[model samples]
Target chain A: MFKKILFICLLPLVASAQETIYDSFVLAPGWTKLSFIPPESGTYTLPTYPKATNGNVINHKSEVKSLYQLYDNKITLLNFMYTTCTDINGCPLATAVFHKIQQKVSKDPVLSKKIRLLSLSFDPKNDTPDVLKLYATGTDKQLVDWQFLTSSSPELLDPILRGYQQRIVKEYDENGNYIGSISHILRVFLIDQEKNVRNIYSVSFLHPDLLINDIKTLLDPKTKNGTVIARSAN
Target chain B: MKKLISTLYGMLMSAFLAVALVPTQAFSDETCMSPYMAKIVGQEDYVYVWTLGQVGVGDEQDKLVTIAVNPNSPHYGNVIGHVSVGGRNEAHHSGFTDDRHYLWAATLDTSKIFIFDVHTNPNKPKLHKVITNFVKASGGIVGPHTTYALPGRMMISGLSNNQDFGGRTALVEYTNDGTYVATYHMPHDENLYGATKTGQIADGYGYDVRALPRRNVMITSSFTGWNNYMMNLGKLMGDSDAMKRFGNTVVVWDLHSRKPKKVFDVPGAPLEIRCAWGSQNNYCFTTTALTSQIWLIYEKDGEWQTESVGTIGDPAKIPLPVDISITADDKHLWVNTWNDGMTRVFDISDPHNAKEVYTKVIGDQVNMLSQSWDGKRVYFTSSLLANWDKADGPEKMPQFFKAYDYKDGELQFKFAIDFATEKLGMPHQMRFGAYSLYAKSPKDGAKVAELSK
Candidate 1:
């Protein structure tokens, strides 16, 4: 019986293993953007971005403004990053992707008029309004519309982070000594004109083209009761 | 005329050779392949076995034991290589990058993540780097349980938090190259699932995460932290306060945003999660370790819902359904009962009406279950929690890996490799490696490298 079982086990080895075709940007190089259709049944849709609870944000010009009011009936792509982030794939990647998106949208009249990007610095102390203004004013003229916002202090940013459910913790050593920096997940929220979060892009999926496709989907007109209802041109 | 005929004959011979060299389909279609996905497919050269030394006896730390898996190889069924990462940090689930180059393994206690460069050599895997400051980096989240790949990064779910160290936990993300990215906390305060009137499941220790990227949705199951799991089994059962420690909820997140969209109450510690194979099947299954039941998460008409699909063993005895593995066709599910030492196979062709098909005992204690790409072979490992693993059972034997042959709805035990006998420790997650390590000679089916005399 043991011999028979061993023989049977060896049978699978004689057979070929499963083929795994991974989804990658390289594999599907021609996929500039995705064309999605609302499913008829058993579908999943992202929840609308909740209204920004903590409205206290200081813009680059040092003016107090509500974070939610910045949406201003526009498609907002909001992300949190510090100016000093050195990780190539962390804050730097997000900033680069935002710049690419800005450059792409500037060419498309529909996207340029409808979408707005927000980069909020969670390190409020170091990234003051003046620092944010300096950080936003890069040589790239294409990023003119992108706004850099920050709070007055870590305390003021707490409610905003909590509302967004962004888990940010200060690093410490095994000896319990402070590491002087914060650890956080990179989440870029894509909010619609109605203040609903349509999607959140992480490091891997945070491509300019993918963001543009999602933006177009949200901008596309909806059919209600067999009538073509045009979305608000915000 | 003779020269023309010779040229035509040579072209025909070359065409025949090319056609014969192509690999034919001889394996069953199995899709979900992450940590276990080998770049070269069926010819898995090495098996990277996560082993824990005799921690209960204070003799060993957790390590990675590489065994030649190619049956025809000379080193087959032998421990040819090992990596001893000192400290018994309760090494659990591991995953591989999408490119199948690096293997990310984590320890629960210290949250120390070890990335092994499996591509360098299938047999001798080198420790590329280590993420040492997970606790400080992930803000108070401790105990990294599951390591899963998402594009170019690895998404890890924690089983405990530093503040309470009971159940409150968070899910963290990091670049595959060991850079800290961000964190998403599971729902603990409000009713995420809206199950009961209060809508609060209390504990939020995250155990497993599975996502449907196309649907832009991901689901996470909950398990208790190390402290709760390592507590005296009898004391934990008797203590009413301790009974409330295990997580009883599953949260669904927007995959793109990493935000919790829905939280459903799955009572009694849901451990392993296996999503169905295809994009059309917008459903996944998770086993409740404490309750001995299998729960199903499905989306209907754009709304998400969860339900108790089926029960695994006698709930009264708490058989402890610890690990779950699904077939490539999404027709069957293999669930391992840690306490009872039995692997139960369920026919999941119909999500709602699942039936138990087969059952077999592999050892005194069984925890993790990994299936081959073809779904024809199922691998079983014995060891759940060091202290909780059959501590008081009749037979306190060594932990081993039992390979079974699944044919026609039955699981027949084929062979067993004893890890405990060699004191190599307890094997947890078993992943496949590249075919180059175990390539066999075509003539006599001999492995290229000869084993040491």
Candidate 2:
């Protein structure tokens, strides 16, 4: 009953305008079969790319919180997205992949306790706290902690967007009116407990299997010292 | 007016969709940029050329030269802006970050990388950052050749090492903000670096690096090191010992783990690696400098394999195939032979058999080629190296930046900017810039009109 209600509520968000956009192009590999086998967890290392920046965000429950607070020493998968993103390969792909990660973690208690998935919206004007609340309905039942967050205004969101280097361009109509649509390259960041970004995944690299492998690699005890095993020179 | 508005609307919609929805490796502006970066789907406003400073040239300083390219713009076909970075550093190649906001131009001699902010003002690009510790930070990696974008980071291929200044080197990774991440050394005969030697040779020399993210593969081609590349071209060619230093292998890597998987013996210094744009194509092409043969690296029966597909012009002549660009459709390839001053188009429709379809003499010496997304407008530059550049007389090298319109199976001359005659330096690599990338429109008023006039 809960799943049906949640699906019904989310249908309108993706049905009319979004379905037309999504149907025009093929789905990204994250939605289909991953063409290549990902490297096994704990076998390879994910070097720290950049430091994940912290910003003020409003959660779906309308509570003000620092992004670092949500991180809370957990291995975080931070994704920038909006609720009404119509592109199948853009925000929808990130969200769907995150959903799969949540499902996989729900079955494994060890990973459930250590993982945090964040879907932060770049379009704060459209994706308000209340809207995200409704959009995030039924996520609480998942074992892994999943947070759908939005900012109160552009002022509060711009810093986080800039820090992550998430470039987005707002679409305009023929008469130069704001169309409530933002175009952005889909980027999902995997941040370690130290707030250092380990890896960034775009549409081609984003997949549940790869994400889980990276998460496990980060959680591996050998990697706790932040030392990557030197690749065999021979 | 209605037709104009409808056409404008159609263009705007197309641009929005292209920027919003296109996946990696789907569409690109220059047809050879990193798939991780955003592409200019419509008209590009500027072509930022990383130029090498000639000794007696106007500034005698390596500079980033910006040429206005949009035909609709008033200042089209003109050198509108330039920013010279102090001194000469053998400006060879430049690439944009994944966000398409910054351009990283590297120098082979100094191992210095100048990052330009192309987004703030596309016309007049400002130097954002200079990475001075590349050699030290990368642990002796020198001559950063190709600055490739991978997700949020830049992967730089090294031509030489500080220890010997020879061919053996490694690929260094850095964050977009110029923070060094890690280095993965190329596999040689003594140390395969966990990569299997499919062929006898496993020379770990490095030149260009490219990735096919869908296949989880990154490919690196090999070229000679600083000892030979910086030496006088005539002298180095005459000296057999220096000539023997040229790379003879191309290494295939696992993109995710940054590890070498296989090394294929592609004798004779493969300069550029251009992979097909089609999602299912799953193949890349490279041409040798000494052998003048086109080689195809493809996957067969779940194993990556390589074979000599076709010959460029004549191996006997040593045309010195330098750079190559593949069209977005993956049907045609533009190969630039620096020695013969010719740009050859190959019908790569059959990947296994690349037949030369057409040829055009670009200039006295052409080193680089960059084509537009539609493969309509092709751009060429004529500088290979400061020491190796061809010159009929002292200070008389025919360095130029030429633009051509490719339509109906032939190249129509559009315009040419003689770098030497204009007192500018030798222009090497050209990267496109646009105002639409940053959601800004071209400036309006008399300045643009006057510049155009």
Candidate 3:
């Protein structure tokens, strides 16, 4: 028992001390590395998807605008989630992942300037613009263009959901009592400057590297053909 | 007379506007985001392998093995380091978080998920924490198959539920910290339960799932869950009742609301789904293992449809196409056949119309395949499920890892690591690891760091 306790105490230390002989891969032969192209302004236009159906949305600031108005000639990562959702994989998961990506973009001016995030609540009855604003207060600290928007009512939100093919179903108990909450498959859409959906991210492929790389790809179309052509403007 | 003329003019104008709006659908153009190509630099290229060890095998445990796969690196193709979690816990698939820092690897049989710190040491991943009570946490969901990272959370697709080993399954969500979030059951059409005759498609088993955010769509394909996977494949195939147990449906979902839109029939164990990487490409491809056919799922005339475009191995012989991977350019797809260990490449330039261009037999049994970000280097592993593997014989090959270079339409085998000879156990899902190229942008740096740590 004493030995087992000691082993348990030292487990983390031993794990931390674990050594890895990772000889950083040489990008070239001479071992000297060149700086990559830092994110830069380019004439790249994100590929267009169908026009995002126009829907009335109230921003966290209590201002009303058409959903397309939020695009504003920049890339947008849009999702449908409520502020009260406690499901880690539903609204909370999307919010958390969106927050992480927002933070990532905040660090890069090129990305922050070109990309925007919009989280809309399907439960307009509960998640008022004020509630959404509270949920998004610290989310977009870098002010990396992250906003939480919601329709004034579920009736108004229906067309938007139908347009995007977003669906929601309520959950009920065996006793036939209304469960107050809902169930849904979490989804995130990548929209371009033209209001076209470029990519939709589900639970998979929603990572920062893939999302940022995709954003960079949209920013610079010349980087195609599988080479990571990162140039440092500095 | 003047009022009648005005009414006629208004009617004509409305008709003209409707026709003009109809053309916009055609001119919409293939709108897609080009895959972000990260230029590899110093310290940027390494492949992370989630290896599964066999029971009673050497070191009997699941491990995360990192390898340097860059062509220019001196240590290319060499195993850099590996961290083993004691116990042959059926570690099958793994995924990276949005930040690419934390990697969640799941064990199917034991219902456990282990988080590894891939960012700290890209090559040497340390087991950060282990969520051991997934069965209870997920409310009895079993056989966790895929671990996909969303922005701040991980979504896992389970093969079966606790109720019974039947086809019923659910998608379990959790915070990056492995806290239980909720479970979304795959919609079941109870009306079709007894109605499904033999060879007919029905929905239930959940295997691999992918999301299309732009379209607000999520798709999950069916595969046998825990109880079905552990049973003898040959015995199960012979039993008529057992044959019906295999999943035969692919479910489409609305991304925002997480509701099922449509469940299309995709017969014979559809294992993997690969959405076209090209921005304009709207269709995704999946392969049926039992039937040995390629299926295309796409939007046609505003409706989602599935068409079997091609076949790899003879369905009669059951070559079992286990995994399907598409090139970064969306020009070609690499389909791995488990029975004969052949990797077939198909031209997907026309997604709806795909043609097999190249075929290479890598080994006796190849299950999973991973390609580099640039689509130049391809890695292969041998191991599908522990019990479902081919019985021992000359054809019953040892588990191995082989890397190949695809250039000029030819697959050049670079190196092979035989786990059977080395007694390293079996190898499974493989994902590449890289450093955090993006800078930190957390509002409270200490708080974010603490959560991530």
Maximum-TM-score candidate: 2
lDDT, ranked from best to worst: 2, 1, 3
Chain A alone, TM-score per model: 0.71, 0.90, 0.72
Badly placed stretches (over 4 Å) of model 3 are: A1-234, B1-44, B191-200, B391-396, B436-453
Per-residue lDDT of model 2, residues B1-453, tens digit only? 436533543454344445444453434347677763556655667889999999888888999999988888788899997999999999999998877889999999999999999878888899999999999999999999899988778999999999999999999999888999999999998988789999889988999999998888999999999999999999998999998999999999999988899999999998899998777789999999999999999998778999998999988988889889998878888899988899999999999999999998987779998987766788999999999888565367898999988898799999999898777899999998877676666774212110100
Question: Scored by CA lDDT, what does every candidate get?
Answer: 0.68, 0.84, 0.66
User: What shift in Å separates residue B98 of candidate 3 from its native position after superposition?
Assistant: 1.3
Model 3, position B430: C-alpha lDDT score: 81
lDDT of 3 at A222: 59
Which regions of candidate 1 are displaced past 4 Å?
A1-107, A110-209, A213-234, B1-41, B56-59, B190-202, B392-395, B436-453
Q: lDDT per residue, candidate 3, B48-144, as tens digits?
A: 7788876655676788877766555567677767788888777888876554567788888887888998756565789999988888877888988
In order, what is each prediction's RMSD in angstroms?
A: 17.4, 6.9, 20.9
> What lDDT is obtained when candidate 3 is compared to the true structure?
0.66
For model 3 chain A, the run of ten residues with the poorest summed lDDT:
A25-34
Fill in the DockQ of model 2: 0.32
Give the TM-scores of the predictions, in the order they appear.
Answer: 0.64, 0.92, 0.60
